[model samples]
Target: MMMHRQYLIDQAIIARNILRVALPLQRLRASATRPTLPETPTRFAIIAGDVTDPSSSLGDLAMFSALMQSLRAQNPDSIFTIIGERRHTIVVPGIGETPVEPAWAGKTGTLAFDELIRQHHALFVMGADILDGKYGAALVQRIVAYCNHSVLLGIPATMLGFSFNRNPRAPAVHALSRLHPHVTVNIRDQPSLDRFTRIVGVLAQLCADSAFLMPSATDPITEPEAWIASMRQEGRTPVGINLNAHALAPAIAEVGMDQLIDHFAEQFKRAGEQNGLAFMLLPHDLKSQSGDVSMLQALDQALQRKGFTHVRYASIDQPDKIKRLIGLLDLAITGRMHLVIASLGSGTPTLSITYQDKFEGLYQHFELSLEHTITPMQCLTDELLRKINDAFMHRHDNRARILSHLPRVKALASQNLAIATCGHTD
Candidate 1:
């Protein structure tokens, strides 16, 4: 039933593309409601994903924060308005919720949406991998429509740094291929660049992920700080673990969550004993379906049953706060890509539980080895313990490698900001 629904949706998208070319959209749009600009050149509209929602993934907030921070640094006089559904007030890290204008409610290709676009000098679609069509055809259509409408109205539009998966849906590829040449689309990694060019048949400039610019908290939270201090006092290395159900959906479906928790608990028990390591459970995503807190909590309980007292949960709400905690770790292991980004960006040795083929491109930016990543199936065996021990032993070398390549990656990340401010993909 689900596959049939997706097929019908894909067909609808293909039909929409044909109608887009056949219909006289320009004449129709010109006759629609027109809104005059406020003469504010710095006025910008940020769309896709609400940065102010408390329930949002910290990773999403991290990207939004990075974009906001970099934009402000490049142009401090910039005035901003979020263009999406209104969200509950959740303070952005290092950036409070009150300063920015409230979200303007208007869907793409509508008269109201057109009026709103005219008021802003520029429009930025926060693609962040959503344009790949895995989410749905509706989202892919909406983003592309928003960009098309913005460019037609003479306001510059830019699709911020995003990734294209190994196999993007044909409908998404078709929609993106129709984008105006004036619209600047930035693909984050080389593999995604290849995928985008092959499918969309358009030129997309390369840039690093924007989460690299996420600012760390001023100081570590008391709980994690105390845990780290105690571990060092006993001469044990602090290892941070971030696990999410989203990445291990297949494994959980096969072996159940309880068995998976038990498996990790047993491995951590043995590895900690042999390697003199203490563990920290770091939860990155907060959504119910893929939330990390519940899984990490269960693993913590299982670890306690095995008499491993060094394990603790770093319960930090803000992305920057958790990033600061990740920075303090001697080594980190995670299924969450943003957590891996935080660790590597902060010069900490890290291992990734590979998913979606996104990690290779990220690691390539650091010139690091793919040996640092493991599959979900590997987590079920003693191989997990072996990898942990190996990573722990080579922590210094990993940290040095990450630090050496940090600047170049950061500069590439900053290029996204330059693209936004300077209004060019080059």
Candidate 2:
């Protein structure tokens, strides 16, 4: 039954891709024969969280980068202004400065927040995190007061991948809806969309996660030679484990990272004793605050205690780290949404340890089995190992299934960019 469902989804995806390419080509040819259209300078204000904080913020930053690139390609005259943490300034070039602290507070710094909005035609407000009641309300009021168009690119209720334990600034969002008819709200998940529609009295448009648009390897990306060589020497199936121990969800705690790692380490150690394939711990978000590095270190220590010497760690700072990490994986079992996204994007089979609805939605979107993906809070190691083994056994089929959706994901992102920039009229 699952195979039949997957086949039907694949057929629909192929049909969608065919239409996307053909329709765009026809539009291009028609435009070419027409008189040249005058170029317009569209200023975009992307209200985002601090990029320096590499938690869920990385997903937003990556999306912003992709959107900026896409917009530049379509409209060279367009200018993008990012309002977030000042520390993020170094990573994103050409971003105009804004006061970082009290992000929700209205115009409490040297920068004239009101004046900046008056100059721009549209404001693209990211996740509701930036919309804390008083501060968010003030910011929204200022934007509505200044800009002709404003949109809240919210995470849809259907997108089960994001961590949404904290209730977003509903009062502020409500205020914006009441103040301006031009104000629009959209979410990434289906359930959120339904609830939002109930609150706002309007059906929100559902969109795919922006992370799908993240850039792939631009350079000669390859796995670390040292890591790959060491794996071959150990003769154990190289499995990448990304466990989110400090996750916001308490359910994740129930899984007990120590037990999870110990079981996998022992299993790999036994395999290594016979044939030599070692398990490698790959921490996706390894920053100090995220606590991924510390968690991995603890797991490393545990593995060492078990006499497992073939384990390796992938440094996040390394060049082409994402590509390198994904490439090295024979299989990936991860709790981080982006790691799963990256692995699937790179055609690497992955078993997702989901704590939120976003993971389930993504699996549904790609027509993958939810049974293969588990919630850590469940702590079913036997089931997890079975899923991991299944993923490896069906690695080729899974990769092909994931690859089939990439073109569609990219096309949807392009369509969203067009709507974000060109669809809004001043």
**Total clashing residue pairs per candidate?**
0, 25
What is the C-alpha lDDT profile of model 1 across 385-422, one tens digit per residue?
98988888888998999999999988888767643322
Estimate, for each residue in 1-426, the C-alpha lDDT of model 2 and write its tens digit. Answer: 986885575455334423433233334334432222234536666666432342243444455655565666777777766654443442431222323322223223213333344345455655423333322334433333322222211111111112222243443344335423344444544554554556556434655555555555455434555666667675556777766664424643555555655765565455455544566676666456665687677767877888877777665542134634676566777777767766766667787876534565567657788777766644444554556656667777877888898777555444445343332222
Q: Per-residue lDDT for 108 in model 2?
A: 37
Model 2 off-target regions past 4 Å? 1-39, 50-57, 76-79, 85-88, 93-103, 106-111, 128-181, 184-186, 189-192, 198-200, 220-226, 229-237, 246-277, 318-320, 420-426
**Per-prediction RMSD in angstroms?**
3.6, 12.9
Q: After superposition, how far is residue 311 of candidate 2 from its true place, in Å?
A: 2.2
Candidate 1 regions exceeding 4 Å error are 1-6, 13-28, 32-41, 50-55, 98-109, 420-426
**How far is 417's C-alpha from truth in model 2 (Å)?**
0.8
Model 1 residue-pair collision total = 0
